[model samples]
Target: MAFCTSTDINCEPCLYNSISVPGKGWCLSCEEGLCQSCVDSHKRRLATKNHKIIEKCHHVASIRHLMSQTCKNHNTILDRYCPFHDDPVCSLCILEKHTNCKGILSLDNVAKNVASSSSLFSLQQNIANLVKNLSQLNKVRTRSSKQLQSDKIVKYTSVRAMRKRLDKHLDTLEEKLLQELSSKAGTCETEINNSLSEIESKTKAAYAVQSNITLLKTMATDVQLFLAIRDIDTSVTTETNWLREFANQHNTDELNLDLNTKPMEDLLRTKSLGSVRIDRIPNHVPINHLNMKEAQIPREAMCNGIDQIQLYQKIHIQYHNEKLVEILFGCIISSNGDIILADGPSKKFTVFNEGGNHIKDIHLPGTPSDLTEISQGRIAVTYGNSKKMEIAEIKDYHYKTVISVRTVASCWGISCDNGQMAVKLLTERINLYDTNGLRIQQIKVEESCPHYINDITIAHRHIYYSYPYQNSVFCLGLDGTLIWKYESDFLQHPRGITTDGYGNVYVVGRHSKNLIVISKDGQNGRELLKCNITPWSVHFDKHYNKLLVRDSEGATVYKVAFRL
Candidate 1:
C-alpha cells in the first residue's frame, strides 16, 4: 500500500526490464524492488554481486515510505553512513558536507544485527514500563471512585436519620444537604472520568509502539529496524517525561464526605441538621522509570574532542593569615579527584576534594611555581628561583617529601607522565627528568620562545606549553621537533596548558580571562569558558573526565562532555 493504489503497483515492478512482474526482493543500494528473475541476475552481475537485498515479504516498502531512502538535500539514494555526524548520506552528500568526516561506513555494515542490539532491548523495556505505569494509575483511580461512592451513601444516610428526630423545619435542611452531597459526588465522578480518558489514550499509544516493535523484530530488515528505533526512542522518552510530571501533579487520592452533625446533637443550639464536607486521604501510585543509559549512548568515542563543559563545583581557598598574600599558580587533579593548588607567594599547597571542600594545606620550605602528579596519590612540585622540584605523597591532610631534583635554571612549569617529567625553566629551555631525578634530555626554545613559557603539559608523546607574553601555544615531539603552534586573539596571555589525551589542548588565558580549546592539528580553536577574573592555571584529569582551574580568588571544577 506504499506509494501505490493497486496490488500490481504496490509491489514495485522489476527494474531490470519493462515487465510488470511483482517484485520478490528489495535492493538496498539500488533502492528498487526486483522480481525473482531479476534477483538472480542482480546477484550474478559484477557491480551488484555484493549488494545487500531484503525480501519484499518483509514489508520493506513501508520502511522506505516512513524513512526516505533518498537524501532530501542531494535527492539521491543514501548508501553511506557517517558515525561522526550520525547521519546517512549519498555520494553527493559525502562530497559536499562529509569530506573530512572520519569513520564513514557502509549503511549495510552499520545496520548489521541492529535488531539484536542493546538499543532495541532498551526500547522494549521502556515501552513495557510505560504500559505498566498507566495500568497502575488506572487501578488507583478505580479504587478511589469506589471509595467515594461508598462514602457518599453513608453521609446521605446520616443526614436523613438526623432529620427524622427534628420538626418540619428540619425537612428543608435534609433536602438541601442531599443536593449538596449529589453535586459534590458528581464533580468527583467527572474528574475521575477525565483522568481515565487520559490514561486510556496513553495506554493505547504505548500498546501501538509495543506492537510495532514486535513487527520490527519479525518482519523488518536490519536497516529498517535501525532507523525506526531512533525515532521510536525519541517518542518514548517524550511520553515518559510527560507521564512522570503528570503523576507528580495529579494523584487520584481517596475522597470522603463528612456529615458535620454538631447542630443535630444540640437541638436548642441551632435549627440546621448538619453540613456536608469533603475529606481527602493521600494516595500514591509509583512509576518505575527505565534506565536511560541506552538513550544517551554516543555515536563516537569521547577521546575525539571536547563538545562542551558544565560547572560542577566551586572551591574557596582559605588563607590562614591575612598578611600572607595568595598568588595561585599550579593546579592538578589527583587520580581520586582531589584538587591541589600551589600558592607561590604564600609558599603552600592547598588541597580540596571533588565536592569542593577544603581538606588541608601543606607548607613548603620554598615557594612552589608548579605541580604535577607523578603517580597515584603522589605529586611533584617545582619551586621557582629555588631551582628545585620536590616529589611528595599527599592525601587529605598528610604530606611527606620523598626527594628533590635540582635544576640548572629557575624551575617554573612542570608535568609528569609514565615516570617521565618535563620541567620548563624561566629561561628558554625545558629539561626532561626521570623518576630518579636524573636529566634525560633538554629542549631549547630560543628561536620560537617569546621571553618565557608559563606552563607545560606532556600527553600522548607530545609536549604542550603556553607563552603568555606572545599569546601562543606550542606542541613538540620527544626529539624536540616543533609539531604545531597555535595563536588566537581570544587566547591572549595564555598561562596553564594541558591536553585531553586525544590531542586537543586546553589552556587558560589570563589577560583575555577565558579558556580556549585548540584542535589536534592546531588549525582550529574556540573559547570554552569566560572567567570572571584572571585564571592563573588549568589541569585536566583524563581518567575522571574532570577539569581543574586556579584563579586569583580560588579554583573550580567542570564535568566535560566530548564528541569527535
Candidate 2:
C-alpha cells in the first residue's frame, strides 16, 4: 500500500497529497512531493539562490529519517532553519550565538516574525526609497556641474574676442605711425647725402691742383720746366682768383646749411621727444546744477577803512525792496561813477550812487529796457515797445534825452567805445551809432540764434554780448563781423557781461546761480561764486580792481575782488 507524502516536506507538494495544505502547486523537479512555493523561495533566498531541490517520495522511509536528524553544531533535529546561523540551531544556540542579530534565526522563528512584525516590511520599503533618492541627487549634481563649466567657457570666449579686437586696432595705429616716421627719415637722409657728396667733390678738386703744382716744381731745373714756369706765373694769378671765388661759394653754402639744416635737426629732435609724451586733449566742463545761497550784508565790515578791493571779497550791501526801484531788465556803471538801471515795464531809467542809494529817476517815454554807458557822460538806452534807441546825458541828478530814433529794431544789448555805441537789435542785426545818435553802420548776423541779448561790453576793439537764451557769449569786430563765439554749458541765462584787464570775460546768470569766468580765448571756463541770488548785472572796476555784482531778486549788491 502507498502512504501519502508528509505535508511539512514542501507546502506545494503537500497541497497535492492525500492530506490537504494551504498552498498548492506542481513542482517540475520535485515531481513526487516538492512544492512550487518552496522551489520559488529556494531560488530567491540569498543562501538558496543556487540550492537544488529534489523530489522526495512518500514511499521512501530513509528520507524521513534524514530530514529529522540533528545538525552536528546545534544538537537540534533538522527542521525549518536559518542558513546564516547553521541549520537546525536550537533555541538555546540562537540565544547564545545569534542573540539580536537580524540574519540569524530559526526558520520557524523567521516565519512567525514575518507574519507578526509590521516594522520589518516598513524597513524594507524605506531602503528602496533611499536608493531612489540617492539616484536623483546624483543626476542633479552632474547636470549643474556641466552647466557651470559651459558658462565659464562662454565668458572666456567673450573676453578673448574683445582682447583680439583691441590688439588689432593698436597694431594698425602703430604701423601707420611708423610708416610716416620712416618716410620723413628717408627725405632727411637724401638731403644729407647730397650735401656730403658736394663737399667730397670740392676736396678732390683741391688735391688735384696741388699735385700739378708739385710736378711743375720738380721739373723747374729742366729747360721745358723753365718755359712752363714762365707760363705758370701768368696762369697762377688767375687760378688764385678762381680759388677765392670757390672759397666764397663754400662759405655761403656752409652758412645756408647752418641756418636751414641745423634748424631741421632741432625740430626733428623736438618731435621725437614729443612722440614719447602723453597727448591728452582738454574737454569742456559742464556747469553743475545747484541752488543759490541767500544774500547777506555785513554791517560791521561796512565801516572799515576805505581800502582797495582785493581779488576776492565778501562785501555785502544793504537792500530794502520798498526803498529801491526795481530795474528788471539791465544795469550799467558810467565813467562818472553813476549807476543806471533799466526799469522796463515802468518805462523809466533809475540812477543810483555807488552806495546803493537811489539818486534820480529818468522817465522814459517808451519803456526804457537796456542801458550802456557811452562817452561824454552820456547813456544809451533801448526801448523795447517802441523798438527804438534813445541817447541821453546824465548831469546833477537829472537825465536829458538828447536823441531818439524809431529806425532801429527792439534793442536788447548796448555797448559803447570811444564815442560810438553798438546796439544788438531784435532783428538779429547790430547797429552802430555815433555819439550824436547818427547811424554809422548796420551788420546782420548769420543764423538767427534764439538768444535774449542781456548785456554788452567792448573789449580789445570788439563788441562782446551775452546770450542768455543759448547760454553762450559772442564777440564781434568793430566792423560788425563775428570774431569769436563761445558756447558755455555752465552758464544759465547769463545776463551781465564784463571784461578784466587780462582779457578774461565775466558773466552773471540769474538762473545759473553763479558767477562764471571764461578765458580770453574761450577755451577754459569756471564758476567763480555760487552765493549771488539772481545776479542781473556785473562790472569790473578798473580803478578799484573790484567786481561789483548786482542781484535784482534780493535787491542787493556784492563786492567781489578781481584778479588777473
TM-scores for the candidates: 0.48, 0.41
lDDT (Cα) of model 2 = 0.51
The lDDT values for all models are 0.74, 0.51
lDDT, residue 306, candidate 2: 22
Winner by TM-score:
1
Q: What are the clash counts of all predictions, listed in order?
A: 0, 1
The candidate 1 region of ten consecutive residues with least summed lDDT is 1-10
Deviation from truth (RMSD, Å), model 1: 17.6
lDDT winner: 1
**Where is model 2 more than 4 Å wrong at Cα?**
1-328, 554-564
Tens digits of per-residue lDDT, candidate 2, 1-564, equal: 011234353364455556554333322222223445556665687865653344343222212321233445777533333333223355666666656533443344332322122222222232233333323333333343354345435533543443354434344433444444444434434443454454354434334333333443332222222222223333333333433453344221211110011232353333221121111222222211111110011211111212211233434444334323334366666667666666666666677776767778877667766777776477778876477887887777567888887754667667676677777776777778887789898877663564354477776677788776677788778887787787776788777788765467888876887788777766667777785456777777543345767675433344443111
Per-residue lDDT for 1-564 in model 1, tens only? 012112232235443345577778877666677777778888999999898776654455434543446677978776788754567788999999999876677876776666666567777888999999999889988988998889888887777677778887666767876888888888888878888888899998888778667766775567667777777777887888878887777556676777776754575456555567767776677666554332122233333344533333444454333322234368888877777777777778787778778888888778888888888878888888888888887765566788988888788889998678999887788889887678899998754453554689988888888887778998899778999988898888888899874578899988899988888888888888899867878888876556787777677776554322
